[model samples]
Target: MLVDDQVPIEEFEGTEFPSPATVHMELRYVDRLLHIEGTVDADAKGVCDSCLDDVERHIHVDVDERLDPHSDRENDPFGESNVLAGNRLDLADLAQQLVLSDMPMGLRCSDECKGLCGICGANKNTGGCSCENDTENHGEPKMEDAAQ
Candidate 1:
């Protein structure tokens, strides 16, 4: 069975995706096991970790899960394996989990971001500020001290 749907990003709170997400799933049932393979595509909006600027990123996640419909729930208290509830599967939940897992730890607009100046809160990438070089270098010895 093939299922394709678009899920609104607003329904999921605490997620980075700001736009609607597209999910495509292919399910194959064999005996008591259901094998699912899918892909999730979305645009994630977040603040850049370095510069604190608004950033929009396109994210794609691959999903693969094996669900057991006839697993003994009482014996496996922890539910180590994915189990189906009755005959229904929650595709939205699965897609959300997969997307979250694939999201980057630190969202950045670019790898070469200059970030904000520590002293004056100036955006260094756009232009320079008077406080650019005024911040103290914590560990390094001063050039005058080294010469002395």
Candidate 2:
């Protein structure tokens, strides 16, 4: 069987999906097992962890799993896909799980992002603030003395 469709999912773990995810998959039944293979693509919008900037990401993931009517999730060495509920696959849950799990931890706008200034509460990447942060000392020690 050929499955090609788009699924609309609003949010996952605080991250927002601005567009519907495109799924192109093929399912084949062999013996008592069902094999599923697909590719999922989506656009995600979120906040940068460091600078609090609006971060957008394009996610593309590959899915490959096999399911059966009787598969053990516990106590057995081998288990089918966790997206399987009862005798059918849960497409919505599958999309959310795959995308969220593949998402990066502590998403950032860039590697060289300067982030925000703790003293003046200003964004350093956007030309920085006028606060005297003791630039001569290389860090907060100079700012401490300047404040005193």
Candidate 3:
């Protein structure tokens, strides 16, 4: 079986995608096991961790799992393989799970991004702020004062 659909981002909280996720799924039933495979593509929008700027990132994830419809708690307590629910499978939920797992821990506009200044709340990448010099000597005492 094959499925192609768009999953809305509203289903997930604290996550935003430029548009609905494109999901392509393929399922094969062999003996008592069902093999599931799919791919999800989306452009996620998030705030940069350091600079607090809007950042858009493209995400592509692959999914692969095996489910045993016959397995139950008594026989498979640990659930080595996922169990199917009735005769229906929720592909949207599965796609969201896969995307969440593949998301990066932190998002950045660029690797060399200069984050905002803690004192003046200025974006260092755009331009330097007066507080830049002040923060440089915040912790260290002046040599003349220390000597006195």
Candidate 4:
């Protein structure tokens, strides 16, 4: 979870990573600084950007950081900050920041995911609808929409 001192960074490759992945941390004490270099892997599952069906995707990240011990502000040279109280450090906050930093801004299952149809609620991936473009301005309105 947290690597305080200096050690080999952990490997989180393959499918063991969380849905959003956690940055693999390798710590090293250099003079008066802590250096971290590693990677993060995450397999996320969410509705397709084009379709409303479940889709799974992977996110990968490479991280390299340095933390200064004597600085008034416990911020890494990379501009990422860690709350440090003397020699004692908060691992929870550090991990949270790493995970958040590795998270993708915008992700999709596939570039060509044909999402659900707006009119008939049909999945376009399985040829459930012959609406051609799957536009919202199609055919008959649903009972819910008609009542409104």
Pick by lDDT: which candidate is best? Answer: 2
TM-scores, all candidates, are 0.74, 0.74, 0.71, 0.55
lDDT of 1 by residue, 20-123 (tens): 78999899997768888988898888888888888888879887888776663354534623334445666666666677667778888798998998878887
Off by over 4 Å in 3: 11-13, 71-84, 130-148
- Model 3 Cα lDDT, one tens digit per residue, 1-148: 9989998654234448769889898998988777889889877888887888888888899878887867743566556343344556656666766777677788787888899988889888887687876655863567657889
Candidate 4 lDDT, 1-148, residue by residue in tens: 3443322222332212333344466767788787767765556555555665665566555657676655524445344444455555444445545644564554445667666777787877788886764344553455458889
In model 3, which residue pairs have backbone atoms overlapping below 3 Å? none
Backbone clash numbers for all candidates listed: 0, 0, 0, 2
Please tell me which model should have the higher lDDT, number 1 or number 4.
1
By lDDT rank, best first, the candidates go 2, 3, 1, 4
Shift in Å, residue 18, candidate 3 = 3.9
Q: Give the lDDT of residue 101 in candidate 2.
A: 71
Error of 3 at 26 (Å): 1.3
lDDT of each: 0.72, 0.77, 0.74, 0.55
Candidate 1 — which residues are off by over 4 angstroms?
Answer: 10-16, 71-83, 133-148
Candidate 2 local Cα displacement, residue 3, angstroms: 1.1
Candidate 2: residue 77 lDDT (0-100):
30
